[model samples]
Target: MSGVKRKHVTLSLNEKLAVLQRLDKGESLQQIAKELNVGVTTIKDWRKNRKDIESYTITIDGENALKHRKTLKRAKLELLDNALWMWFCQERRKGTPISGPILKEKAIVLHKKLKAESEFAASEGWIDRWKNRHGVRFVSISGEKLSADNEAAREFCVKFQEIFKENEMLPCQVYNIDETGLNFKMLPTKTLAASNESVTGTKLMKDRITVAPCSNADGTHKLPLFVIGKSKKPRAFKNLNPSSLPVYYRNQKSAWMDCNLFKSWFFDEFVPSVEKNLKEKKLPARAILLLDNAPSHPPEQELVKGDIKALFLPPNVTSLIQPMDQGAIEWLKRRYRRKYISSILEKSEQGFNIFEAMKSLTIKDAIYTIAASWDELKPDTLRKSWRKLWPEVMTETDQTEDQQNNDSQEIVKDLQTLDPNVLASEVEDWITECDKDCDSYEELDDDQILAAVIETDNKETANEDSDCEEDELPTRISHTDAKNAFDIALQYIEQNPTSTPMDILWIKKWRDTAAKSRISCAKQKSITDFFTK
Candidate 1:
């Protein structure tokens, strides 16, 4: 039999992109075919279906490539890129040397580990393509070890560069938003504990408030902090001006960031603030809000208005490349802890029990500290954190390990002065302990806790009714403490006749859920009482 004729050669995605680029540059099909060593018929076919080719195109690493999800081969290439990047970062962190030959060996092993097609050749040419795709540059690891995914980091850097280039965005137009859980009962790293004792007797409260902090890449603009708490109108603000607090405060049942609240914050707080800032700066009100794909973030389907664009960081890579994760949130938490430590010392001098004083620490005080801590974060620190993602914005005077060490040492010294018996080595352990008993206040039996809240609301309402002394019928009626919350919700709806369908739906769901919980608690309580009787 005659030898089988060869089928058409397959051009890689990059090559296809190059061919397309050449075609767009007005190159003749014949010239392109000669240059690429492909048939004129093949070139003509690719040119004919240019739109389809363009649809599959995406810029990967740095240059144009086919989107991985388009084909099995592309998907494998993506896996290789990700696995290689992960390995490279891990090795770099371990202070190991990396070279071309070593990288090739690692690539082969990674390919096998990924259970990819064994026959697929991961050759030196492929490695070279990988390097060029990601714009990877080999440099010796220096200074402190850090966790980073090299491919992800490089991708972010390249993508960020492209965004800036395409949008012609100023540093102020680009922003990153992140939320952190701030445990109010958190104590300093040092405390008065017995020498040589393995455990400290004190338990830290795990009661937490979530704060969303946003700042631009250039550090020239910082958005007002958005705070979430359990109470919409906490007793802490009873006698004070809530407006005096620096943060934009809202509340949820869990005191955690939720999608609805995040949306509200985006439209009501973030957009308005950005608009004002733009007006002040005499710049157009356009923004690029970079966010993590956290569950609390609104689903991508939500429409963003005006000239704002929402960009999400790659999954699982936010921790490695997010500016807030780098050090901004950590620094703010440290400052807050330092303030907490100072408060402990002062209250102790005045003969207040340390734990009790902490329990009495109000949301107002926490907000104050949160604002102050944010103020303490240097612009340079914020800019430096973007180094892995946007190196162009990084200042030359990045804080050295020694400088960070000195700052840490100062905190330790201050903590030591406050609690003489506290050991330097144990400071971090103590800080970790501060979040332990955070939910202690909420540990009561479900029914009893609900009853207490209802009772408080009843008393407050009675006083208001007495002051008004109108003959108008009560908008809500609570026959027992069990139904108080539902009644209050009903009252809220009745008072706000303009409630949207969503608001009404939420109220109904909330009331039904609460009613079920109340009934469950009551039945359990009755059974316990019957057994005791």
Candidate 2:
């Protein structure tokens, strides 16, 4: 410990945490001394500064403080703050998730209304907290008791929990689906209160290169009825011409996301593939589709109008109940982002062919990358938001009787799975496993890589000089070409590999001359001789 008693200091909570973490590690006292660049006692005194944090807890003891009080005490409001913060903390603990300003706007609306009327309101940092922001604002609260725990709350829970049980979704069949905007550009994070020469002035960047597909379910390849915007633009806003968000858009030349860009791909390309699989598997033709309230994409009104029917999830509850965020999407993204970044470093150290590079990786490899962070993305992480959201979902009816039964069944299963609450421990376990895979990459020498590039660049020289250089060796080129040509015909036979007797005539007509030519030309001759049928 440093000898100097520390002076009063003001640092962001993160900075405080960093200092505490370093101190907890029992690392170099000398390093600590050098950091504060003061006497050893200064750091020692700083440790004492942590004790002054005055651990605060709010508890209402009046006979009817629980029933009659319209507003909460400073301590009570502080408790709510702690709860919301912890709610977010749990979400973050599972994965690196954060909330943002728009969420603050929604979450603060009630507290704002309450603050305007209540005398105890000044004690609550309502405005400061409301101004809090996150790039991924997944949680918000009304500063009121999330009614799901009350008698009304209990009914709501029972409803969904009952539905979850009735469905008997067999683990795999129970799926939560939701769509999110894959923003082409992201905004920067800022502080609620601009600090006095503090507040971690260094800002963190917000944009993500890929889409975030988070769900409340577990496992891999809960592949979606993927809807891609075909327009080769960004995924949502089409009417805005290319240069609208110029300064914010990368390189000032990239296209905006559009509904048009994703429509054709979703309708034509994606649906056909999913439908094909459903047909092959003999699955029920109808699927439960979770949708958001965004008017920009296909709205719920459009679903009925278009006759492309799907079971809509309860409006806002999808974020809590939907399986997409159960770690699948986030993991998918983490894995892909890491692999993509790693690939850029390895394959195209100079520059890579993006399509060819991504294509080279197996689908499973891509899954593994995403799975790496999957566990950290858990449903419990969003429990705070879910608690607030549950009652609202219960009030809405979006189900047929059968659908209701299935949804009820799934809720029971989920609650039973989470009954004892081992979520924090499970998330920690996942983190340990995931971190083990960090920085595991193959090393490649630049010179060796450059040499391979040189070989490719010089291939023309080898081809030009090949004819004159061969001494008197038997040129096996004809034999190799003949064997390759026969292999193609043989392959066709292998699949339809059994050639008929006229096929023998075809082979004879073809093999004698066709074996020397391309499969395309040989196919023409074969077709010419075959019956029209």
Candidate 3:
């Protein structure tokens, strides 16, 4: 008897990027092909077209392209579409209200201006498709005037419960994801002053990054952290491979989450992680991913896969019932701040100049610390965060408000210890400082939009000049140097009575891994050899 033929899988642009990232990490074509359930030839084709794939993947239109499958087709009237999109962005940035008819008229004008050889009607069908392709939507100008609709939230909860029962979804099969802004380098606003000393405040470091955390209700699986920053290549990452970083890092001019980035993250990270986790737990591949109505989020229709689907929470009620907003994000931030402060204090005690130490903090350091803090978030804390939205998921042993309060108090105490002038109230303010301006989808102002346009135009020139201004690459540690450092640490631990047997064992294990890695690297020929040969 013959076996049934396997169906083919078409990868989206986001998925292609994920595949590229894996290949960059030196995964073999066969290995990736097996994992993705595709043939090696497909992987080879992607590798061959890597440059074109990367070029399209970074453009404004490219980011918001279809998420279901790869679409390399240009608009029937490419020049007209480009001009129309640019005009639309300019008007939107100027806070000018745009209607469908207005857009169509503008498109017609642009078509005429471009003097394209092809005829252009700018019909309603074309407008609708264009909007979908670009991920454009009509939004309220006075968004601030709206308030949370409690009645709607209550109704949605009942509807949500019905869907939950109908789908036969377990707590482990359901997930929630949200994004929060981090002022990664911000310090406390209040500090202690000598009785007779004049106190002056330094400017706040507003350097920002956006972090998106995802986990199932049971907290059995936490997806890799997705981070967005202002720079594509930060100086601190020189000589370091970004693909090897703990978190999945992306970049935008505003360091904010947008439709393109979110869509990419959904397909590239969330779906695969969830599918793998479900398989490991011996559960069905079916699941539901709950999201808020952030403007950046693609519509639910676009998010459906084989057995997984995306569901949106009722508008404006996210603050009340969103799982992450309930306390998960706040707790993560508090944990991150505590870890950051502890690092500074530890180095200061080691006799390093405090100012220099603080100045030395880099995006790379912040990223590793964020990953560590997320890992440290207890499962109980995550499960309890769902109480307001899905009370039945709660257990008798779920963490309580008092326990969380105690954690906050501990962080406050640490802050106070770090700066004698810092008050409990000040620490409290500082902890929530990033939350104030870090909306998941920050609308660009007129000036910001203009600046972004300019930046996009000059991106190639900027990339060319970046190398000349980059910081010196950090020196690589050789295998011998690594062994010596490990040996020194082992010697110190042997002399210290407090050091455990496990500590010595960890050092030796690290040494072995380093040695093995060095051997592996020595056996692989450099890419330069291929071209030279």
Candidate 4:
């Protein structure tokens, strides 16, 4: 018996757990070792590290690994796993690319940081398992240079510091203005489709809208959004007043921001809004408006009034230094996409076809969602985003980094619950898509994938007529269209029984206004006018 040979067998995580559970239930480690054909010290060590053993939640693939009798080589480093999890998320939030080799090196570094035993080996197999456990995968990096010119970035930072110090500008006195395109039809390519059905149907080449958003450094001033669309008057807007909407709307043949429009926005919208914001805050009207030198931006050094001045970032430096590009716009897009998904679920629940519900998403809906998204941005996010460009301006008092990490976990959880078949990589892909625009503004280019400007003979004739010296006629809505709008509002109120009293009152007032406006409409084209006049 003393000379009997025992076969060497590796225990899987489950076997390890079983042995540990037996030890927990008052069974002696010696008894488990004898029964499991292992040394007593192996059982004793498993019992001593029960917390670490229990903390290792096996994933579906990990469970499959256990079924195939795979050893938990990397998973055994529970403390290192916990530490690496935190570090990985932080790096991911900073938009840092973590390749397999880079992560392996980091794991080795973290082991040294944690001062773990020299036995901690981060093998390639362990790295793959670790990635699966943490939902990490290699994604193609887009719209960012892996390496930036340090000298150029430093020179721009110096220039920014000078301008900022010269102006003695408060956080609210400084601003960043940028534009992005929202493709309303863009949906996450992941969905819970029938097993036999192709998921490629989710892709739609929908039209895009350009949105101009501006925010101050202190997160105090989020100006009203300026949304540009190809259609000057959408059918959804027929019975509505454009000026009454929360966003300022504009139309262009190309649906792109141009110098003429930028100039008008500067004088008419941006300047006035800043003045009013400053007045309310009891600060001077003087402020610094930081802009990237895009072709659409007008070249105006001096303001028509007030001491507000425009500062342009050096060419090719925006990705390295722009605050909005760092994270603000990315947060807005993520929030907007979440809202869009929420709307789809809500409308689908109310007996509407999902496609039809998505089709009903108008520019008004986009404006509201985009504005709310901008408002939801943590102030710390705004300040920290400037770290690349103006690290000196960053403050240490913000808990946004932790909050964002928590929020991302919650989002992944919610999305997984919504569609269990959804891939973790798909969620990450959606996030990467959201982050793409943060690197640069959407400049109009000849090779852009945007829709071509649709032209027709009738449209040409209308454009010609628009240039004529015709008298200004009062705008009017058709009585039938007005009635239909009122009915739709009433139906919405009826369907949403959760509507508050204030909501009902607003609907009533809107309906009454629509009715009165229809009554006061200009004389309709009549048969008598066609013959006599």
What's each prediction's TM-score?
A: 0.52, 0.29, 0.68, 0.55
Candidates 1 and 2 compared by lDDT, better number: 1
Order the candidate numbers by TM-score, best to worst. Answer: 3, 4, 1, 2
Q: What lDDT score goes with residue 518 in model 4?
A: 64
* Candidate 4 C-alpha error for residue 126, in Å: 68
Per-residue lDDT of model 1, residues 87-146, tens digit only: 554354344567787788877776665565556566877887676554455533344544
Whole-model Cα lDDT of every candidate shown, in order? 0.65, 0.35, 0.72, 0.63
- lDDT-superior candidate, 2 or 4: 4
Badly placed stretches (over 4 Å) of model 1 are 1-149, 188-206, 301-303, 397-407, 431-533
The 10 consecutive residues of candidate 4 with the worst lDDT sum are 449-458
- TM-score for candidate 2, please give it: 0.29
**Each candidate: how many clashes?**
6, 58, 2, 0
Off by over 4 Å in 4: 1-147, 192-203, 300-306, 391-396, 401-419, 434-533
Checking candidate 3 for backbone clashes, the offending pairs are 191-421, 192-421
Q: Per-residue alpha-carbon lDDT of model 4 for 271-315, expressed as tens digits? A: 899999999999878888887756566433322243776777655
Tens-digit lDDT track of model 3 for 1-533: 76976578888887887787677667787988988899889888988997676555433343345364385656676556655665665454334567777788877776665556778788878987777556665423443334666877788888888998998888999999999988766656443232222333332333568899999998888887899776788777767877889998987666778766887787788888888988998987789999987756655655755568889886668888889998899888888888877787777678764454455677778899999999988788899889888988888888455545665677677666656666777777777774676655666443444444345444321231232133345577887688778888889998999999999999999888877877777666465567689
Given candidate 3, what's the lDDT at residue 220? 82
Native-to-model Cα distance after best TM-score fit, residue 322 in candidate 4, in Å: 0.5
lDDT score at residue 469, model 1, on the 0-100 scale: 26
At residue 145, give the lDDT of candidate 3: 32
Worst 10 residues of 3 by lDDT: 460-469
Compared with the true structure, model 4 gives a TM-score of 0.55
Q: Pick the candidate with the highest TM-score.
A: 3
Top-lDDT structure, candidate number: 3
